[model samples]
Target: MATILVDLDGTLLPLDAWNPVFAEICKAIAERAGAPPDEVWRRAREKNLILMRRLDWRAFDWQQLFDAVAEELGAGRAPSVLEVLDKHLPRFRPTDGALEALRELRAMGHRVEIATNGHASYQLPVIRRLGLDEIVDGVRTSDAYRCPKTCPQYFQDADLMVGDNPIFDVYFPKRFGLLAIFYGDWEREAAEHSRRLAISIDAVRPDHVVKNLKELPDAVRRVLALR
Candidate 1:
């Protein structure tokens, strides 16, 4: 039985539209608090990257971070920040090919799971909304494990998981002795960063490199063949 763990944001969904939706949500929140939208966006982006890199997802909730940022901007908002965030959940859209690709992979008898970063309050709805709940056999969100993909322990349970970082992202599955796939799209800046950092997307030498979900089933088969 080959288990395949998949990524959520950029891997299963197209981030081009999602990024702007996120920006719009931040703008809305900033406007409500009478803060500069661009400044709020910049600060939030910086903080999020810092948090992810530091693997601090478990230490803070989105509401706490938002409130702190709001306070920094002289707003001193409260729980309403979370409510405003909830309103924007419907904005996310999975890639046009995601559902079809997932269905095909499932049909091939591979156990598919979602190994992603983010809290359940925010991540679960996105998964359900995208119909991922129907195709994936399980989900492993950072909130569930109290650690992000950047933490090797988080991937320890995945049968197979796709990620950009061979070191941290691919660590769990590899450590567990499961096949790991490196999902790399050179067209995107983040994928380019993964490449430049020599993060071992290929160096850790994933079982395969898939540019998109459409290529995933074949990659799984190739991995199985090697076994």
Candidate 2:
């Protein structure tokens, strides 16, 4: 049986839509802090990117980041900000064909696993809510190891369990000898993102490039046939 590793954020769930959900949470945070909504959004977004860019994932906690943003706006508003975020958890909906694709992969005898760069506390609940637990055999999150997917060790661990590795940062997974499946809408976009991120997707090249999850099973089968 082939073990299939999948990404959660844009790959399984539709994060593009979820950005507004986050934005709403930020807006609420800003309102509670008594700061102009735009100012709060600007500060939080800037801080978020800075924290995400850190090589050490443990250096920041997203909840703490929200709290700090609230503090920067002024104290006595952290609780309200957290409440706003907690309420928006239900906004994380998977893409249109995601669940159907997961079912097909399982029915076809693939050992599906979620290999994601999110915190387990956040990722697992969304997976469960989307009913992905029914299809996936297991899940790996960056929070578990206190490292992001950019770390080769995270990929090494995933490669040990699943033969199918979804390419997020190609160089990281390639270093661990996993077959890369570049999941994106456009080859040009994928290529550019890989280059800017300092990852080498071209060297391994992706075994497949899928625009949607519905195309994944056939892509997996083709790769397996070649093997």
Candidate 3:
């Protein structure tokens, strides 16, 4: 038996498919802000950068993100994060293969738990909507630890980590002495979200890279075998 921690956003509930929907959201927000969609993203990114700097990548609510776009664009009525999320709750779904992988891992007697940087306010809703609440062992967010998983010290007693972000999920957890299973879309993420790409993963071999979430069971087996 083993203890395992997995990420939420890209690892289990992949956001790649929601890119278009999110773009539509920005457009709607732009209309409300009376600004161009590009400007909306600029302000959002600007605020996001500052927030990341101040908080060092801890869990952040969607309200915070929406507030940034609204305040920076001087639009008080821009669509809120909850409004958009609630509207799309019916469409929310996790990777089917990943869900099965968790169940299989659990069947193998490994404790599968979610260790995410996403806030409970919204992440919990998705967890419930997707019925993930019944799948995994439990969920632990950054708010619970008072720091993001980017800090190597976050996994003081964990055995393993499964996530997408190479830096925060792979390198940091590995630095903390836990094995990391990298779950990400390398080709799709390259030349865009470099953070999700395994650029620095070469430095750490045998980190257990898997392109498909379905391969998680074998990866976990490999890591457990190593121990």
Which ranking of candidates, highest lDDT first?
Answer: 3, 1, 2
Runs of candidate 1 with Cα error greater than 4 angstroms are 32-34, 59-61, 78-91, 164-168, 171-176, 186-203
- Candidate 2's residue-wise lDDT over 130-227, tens digit each? 88888888887888867876676676544322222333445456566666666664467656655544444665566567776778778777777776
Model 3 stretches with alpha carbons more than 4 Å out: 17-21, 53-55, 185-202
lDDT of 3: 0.73
TM-scores, all candidates, are 0.80, 0.80, 0.85
- Shift in Å, residue 204, candidate 3: 3.3
Question: lDDT tens digits, residues 1-227, model 1?
Answer: 66677778667865563455456556766886887778776777667766655657653356666666777877665345335546655776787567887888889887788777767776677788777998888888777778776666666655677765454446546766777777774335335555544443433456678776678778878877887
Residue-level lDDT for 97 in candidate 2 = 76
List per-candidate RMSD values in Å: 3.4, 3.6, 3.1
Q: Give the TM-score (vs. native) of candidate 1.
A: 0.80
The Cα RMSD in angstroms, rounded to one decimal, for candidate 2 relative to the true structure is 3.6
Each prediction's number of clashing residue pairs: 2, 0, 0
Q: Taking the tens digit of each residue's C-alpha lDDT, what string does model 3 give over 54-88?
A: 55543265566766677667777456566677777
Please identify which of the two predictions, 1 or 2, would achieve the higher lDDT against the true structure: 1
Which lDDT value does model 3 have at 15? Answer: 70
